[model samples]
Target chain A: MTIHHQSATQLTRIICAGDISAYEVTTASLEQIQAENPNLNAAITICAEKAQAAAKRLDESIGRGEIPGPLAGVPIVVKDNLCTEGVETTAGSHILRGHIPPFTATAVARLVNAGAIIVAKSNLDEFAMGSSTEHSAFGATKNPWDHTRVPGGSSGGSAAAVAAGWAPISLGSDTGGSIRQPASLCGVYGLKPTWGRVSRFGLIAFASSLDQVGPFARTAQDLAAALQVMAGHDPHDATSTAYATDALNTALEKDIRGQRIGICPEWMSGNGLSTGVADTVSHAIEVFEKMGAKIVEVTLPKTQEALAAYYVLAPAEASSNLARFDGVRFGVRNEANTLPEMYKSTRGTQFGDEVIRRILLGTFVLSDGYREAYYRQAQRVRGQITHEFESAFADCDLIASPTSPVIAPLIGAQTDPLAMYRMDEFTIGANLAGLPALSIPCGYSDSMPVGLQLIAPKFREERLLSIAAAYERHAGQPGVAS
Target chain B: MPDITSDDVHRLAELARLTVDSARVETLAAELSDITEYVQVLRSVTCTVTPSPHAMSSVRKDEVNPSLDREELLNAAPHSDADGFIVPRVVG
Candidate 1:
């Protein structure tokens, strides 16, 4: 069997059944990463020795008559932003190039505890800043489907790694559609849980309130398996929710019959939406209807404002969160005669254009005289957007939309920053409302994947996964680009 | 639409503690202006959005927690001595 192509859930079952050693699975995953990484640029740091050591440990444990953990021996990649103890965690920026995290993120630690092997660290936009991985100081990750096109980001590398078959599952962080947009462009399943569903102990923060670590996988069931391990509270993160995550895997078995799927006309027919996307979504809605689900038109009139609000609010938060990287404590430092000069030159040279642009914009908005006009007003609009979602959810069990307005653009097709920001329009609403949302491949558009996104109210991951699982079972899994 | 002047750009950069190269200042000014203009749409919107109770109010109880040892943390620092992180003199 092609072990690397198997889903993480299936690989675990196979490994536990003694059909394959965990070491063999890890080897195959490592080999795949080595083979595909040059063309895809999906992984920024490959951990062959560490992965082999981990796999050997798991295999020995299973040989000792021990019951394998939930994900036993599944090879996974994590976005560069997530800290891994003893391994370099760059967050795809030059500032932290050689900085090895002393501790691991709670989400990655939980996955490791569940018996998953970490094989590599995937690439992303610098500090998870942009819609495309082009913002990475390393280099942009190319779309596996079309080399000229980009793998959507800032979780672009995680999604691309899964699509390229380097690993069956990987982790990504979504502050504003980082996970889902990339997952859509790559033809995989990505889930952004309720804001506090997954702990953010060591995730390099871009926007604290909106950022949540999520899983990207080839199948919804595999995504559910990952979430089973990742979701829960941590003493380290006060924002981590204590919500019960039991029965999430079991919830995948439920059907979507009698469920109300909301379709917002404003979102579906919004500007920038291509005919290919609209047609693909229309067909997906029909699939749900055929399965005895009801489709209803719901209103979220404030949907358009979400994009603007996210930009303001996210940058405002980022400006504060990123102040820690000043040359003194950790990471790269440039020499200067004075401490303040050291800070200015170190940051000025290390941060990428997009990161600096955001920092400056954030400073401008949060500046003394302009706070009311920009930051405060954006916060109010964020509340209104959240309220719009809550009101819409009252009439529907789940809201459905295209994960992105259009297919993945060519790698350099979107040089203008505002144009790139528009790519996340369809997916940012969930972030604003702090809702759980899933993006699964609906169909192909221009040969690229078109994602049908299903969003549920806060803490309703079970609903999102169940619906996604039902759709995947019927439609069959989307094919990866060769 | 708000025009972001070169002065505004420099002031914002100073506040952010980020040095904007003179060569890139003009481009940054234009880009910042575009973004600011785009976000200005929110100014016309009026809605009552209360702060989320859980988001604003939730805090873990102050408690003892296991933390990374000092050596491991110091190892990642740019400059450190036996005492602690070494930096340029703070006292002028």
Candidate 2:
């Protein structure tokens, strides 16, 4: 049967039943990546040889009577920001054009150990900086549904790759809607776990407090399966804590008959929601009501500050984390007569205009004179936003909103850069508060997908998944492009 | 707003330890001022003190862990030699 782009859960069932060998699956995935990627530019790097080798290894294990691990033989792509051994890990930046990670990221290792094959490294905005994948120095990853439009980013390529059948499942990092926004813009399922739930040891940091590794898949079940493997603690990542991921797995069995889904009023009042975006979300709220979910209209008053605080806080932390890329150590470095000159020249020359703008802005915000005025102020407001979410959750089980203000924008549509940043309006608040959030395809407009976002309190991913699964099961399931 | 002057932009650039393209500095200066003005909206909110937002409070127990080897760390470098990544001269 045509299992191309089917959920990994669905595909694995077939593999277990012996309908297709892992080799067949892997080769199909490779061919899909090759055929589809050129039109979309979703892949920044492909590993055809290694993928074949990995598929062969899986096939031998199955022959030897070894139990195919969970998600056995499913192919997945990863955002380039995650470190993977033997593959170049440039986060769509000229600075790290050909840099490789000698040791694999824990998330990658977990997926590999679970018998999943790596397909390719997907494109992204430089250093995970922009809402559109357009900022990539390598090249923009276009939305699969409409090539003229941007694939929402910095995980746009990850989301778009899954939507386009290049990979059934993929990994994306969400510092501030880096996963969900793209997953929304491209019709797919993306989940950002509560902070510290997933190990971040090898995720190249965009912002320390906000960065989270999440799974993007064609279906919620597939997302849950991927997260079950990738979530948990690594002593290597001090911020990541240990957890029994069975909570997420068990969520599928949780009854969502009487759950209270929060209809956040802040979403309705927001300025940028397109007619398409609002209609899709309104339809979702109606579905929740019909499924016996008590819908409560909730007010998160401080949410107005979410956008401003995210920009300030994410950039402030990014300025520090990205300092390692100077010519003194790794990645691209232009030689100069002096060491100081080399550091300046390398970054100034290699980094893109958007990345440079961020560095300068971050440098200024965190500067000695401006620290109290900008950085400290942002921290205080971040606290307020967090408190606002906590208070809102006191009356609701899952907070719901539109993942993006609109479907993917046309590539380079806005002349002003700050106007482009405004597209992240709906999803950034969850990141600021360190909450678990998911984006599931709800409806379509102009043949592009819109996502209905469900957020839960810290580490409450299982319940969030339960709500999403119930919705997906009834609403024709997520991942089908309209 | 600070009504930031050209000298202020030059000084901030110096403190940031990079040279700003002089041509772009004026436009950037205006944008920064607007952003800084916009961010002033936060000053009105009073927050009850919380030490830090981190959920895990106690220090993580120090323990032995397997780290990426020297070769692994050096693999990310753009310019490396037998000893390690080569640089122009830190001790100028």
Candidate 3:
């Protein structure tokens, strides 16, 4: 069962039935990412000779007959903030340490044109601000179930390289709750989508309207086949969403009877949840009320002003999309001698300290007497949290909640900064209302992992990945990391 | 709700060109005044809704594409060569 514990839809159906050979499952996923990325440091650029030369050219174009696609040779990873053309991509920041990216990242070029293979480059938090990836400057990733916790993060190295099996699927991004809070602290199945349902061109910018990029599987049909090969529309991401996406592996054999499913009740009687994540989201809403859905409850009533309007509209759009890392165009420049000391000594020694405290609280909420008191009252409390998720999806069809209200702390537990921005109180109201959520893993507390989020609306995402593949087939799998 | 001093972290590290280390400007003026007093709860939440902005604009077809490769982005800049990228001397 190796090949890094199967799943990219079971290694693209046994490498399209040749019984195995996408170069022997990309050489057993580059030998389980070189024996589990040094005990789960969940990758930071280990493209083993460009993923064994793209799995030996998808095993010589499937022995000269072709036909593969739909993620053929599988293997994956991504998330060093997308753009991967010659790799380096450091969004986990050191002012783009040894830059590189001369392109590629229309969702990692639609998962390497649907035949996967990337193989490495995870780590995040620096430019993705933080929720722990211990604000990565290329370090903290742990939590392959618990190496003193913290795998939850700005896509904590693509959810600890898909819960340590070293990639069955990966890609990461999601602005607030960087990929479902590190795929709910590395248990797996993350999602996010919907915002512009996937295309963010090269992805680097932090809060470009609460980013998107998605995927991080461990099931739910390899997160709906890596969201049907990284969802659609591109023309280099002019906020994508031109449409035609739904084909989530043919809505994973539908089944959410009588649907409904809302929940919320001020997110399960609030107060920063955690009673084993509100009894594992009330046993995943009583296993979706024993598979006939309905649940109800609702009332998003401005889900507590979505973590204070996503910390003032994602640090006022990450200080205007990181005023393009000045140090003369790209990265590493610092020698200074005016030009504003080379943009303050190359982003003050290649940013960190929570990206220079969110670019000085996003240049003090877009300065000039605090733009109508903090970025237009956090864009009118982000249009009342997108009209309370459009009036709770006008009476529910998907909501759930509790992606992270607790669990996975340990790794230097909360070193303030508003206690690490309340570790994105239950995933920043679906990235401040752009919607389509997901997460999954629902169960386990002191023994970590909990997640269960869901969400939906806006580009429905094939009914949010067929209700997370019918609650991941009645909450079974989710364990891995051995 | 004022507080973040050290001259507002030296005018927000001089409008975020960012360089603040006077021993971390009194701990970034006490963590930017505890995150601007916790995002002043979005200025007491009285939203009369209007903000829209969620980016779904599209537009294309203004022609002229194929760009990128000015000598491989001027050999990834940091003070490039061949008539480009070496900034600093803003006109005499």
Local distance difference test, per candidate?
Answer: 0.89, 0.82, 0.81
lDDT, candidate 1, B1-92, per-residue tens:
46999999888888887788999999999998898888877878888767453463267667887768988788789999878998888895
- Write model 2 residue lDDT over A14-40, tens digit each, in one string: 887778788888898899789878878
- For candidate 3, lDDT tens digit of each residue in A1-482? 66657788778888888888887777787787788788677677888888888888888898898898988888888888888887788888888788897888888887788898888888877877887788888888788887888887888888888887777788888878888977887778888888887788888888888888888888888788777777777787778766676566678789879989888777775667778888877888898889898888878855456887788778878877888897787778787667887898788778888888887888888888878988888877877878878888999888887888888888887888787688677788888788888888887887878888888888887787777788778767786865
Off by over 4 Å in 1: B53-58
TM-score of the second chain in each model?
0.81, 0.74, 0.38
Tens digit per residue, CA lDDT, model 1, A371-397: 988888887888888888899989999
**What order do you get sorting by TM-score, best first?**
1, 2, 3
Off by over 4 Å in 2: A479-482, B3-9, B49-51, B57-66, B90-92
**Candidate 2 residue-wise lDDT at A254:** 75
lDDT of model 3, residue A167: 73
Count clashes in each candidate, considering only residues at least 3 apart in sequence or on different chains.
0, 0, 1
Give TM per candidate.
0.98, 0.96, 0.38
Error of 1 at A228 (Å): 0.9
- DockQ for every model, please: 0.69, 0.50, 0.31
Q: Rank candidates by lDDT, best first.
A: 1, 2, 3
Clash tally for model 3: 1
DockQ-based ranking, best first? 1, 2, 3
